[model samples]
Target: MTSVAVKARVTGRVQGVAFRTWARAEAVRHGLSGWIRNEPDGSVRALLMGPAASVADMVRRMGRGPGAASVKDVLTERTDPEPGVSGFRIVG
Candidate 1:
């Protein structure tokens, strides 16, 4: 399987919601490694690296976010996976 890294920014009603928590859980479930965090601009940003298929699924889930989150947009940029990401996390 090809490993890929994605940098994503989810906008709208994402702040103060369980978006990051949901994202972390989803990433772990997909066996991906990276981190999710809330941006100062009220968006949720994430860096995900894993199998291409799994990363795709994670991105889809991030587009929807948690039930309480109103995700208006999800912008993702595909890139090369980095080395040494132990597990999925919620970063500052």
Candidate 2:
């Protein structure tokens, strides 16, 4: 399958809202590999890598986030995939 990687930056009510945990679960459920983290700028950033379709789906899901998150924007960009990444997780 064609694998791809994408970095997504989520803004608006993303911090301190369990967004990282929710993102991790979504990535795992999609069998993706990468990481999600809280940025100091009050945004959530996530790198998603997997089958092209799965990555796209993950990005879409991030737009909604958890119920506590009032996602205002989801900015995404294609990036080089990390070959050593395993399961998804919350990272610093």
Candidate number achieving the greatest TM-score relative to the actual structure: 2
Across 1-92, the per-residue lDDT of candidate 1 in tens digits comes to: 98889999999999888888888988898899999888889998999999899999988888888999999999999876667877999987
Candidate 1: Cα lDDT at 85: 76
Instruction: Name the lDDT value of residue 28 in candidate 1.
Output: 91
Model 1: weakest 10-residue lDDT segment is: 77-86
lDDT winner:
2
TM-score of 1: 0.95
Which runs of model 1 end up more than 4 angstroms from their true locations?
Answer: none
What are the Cα lDDT values of the candidates? 0.89, 0.93
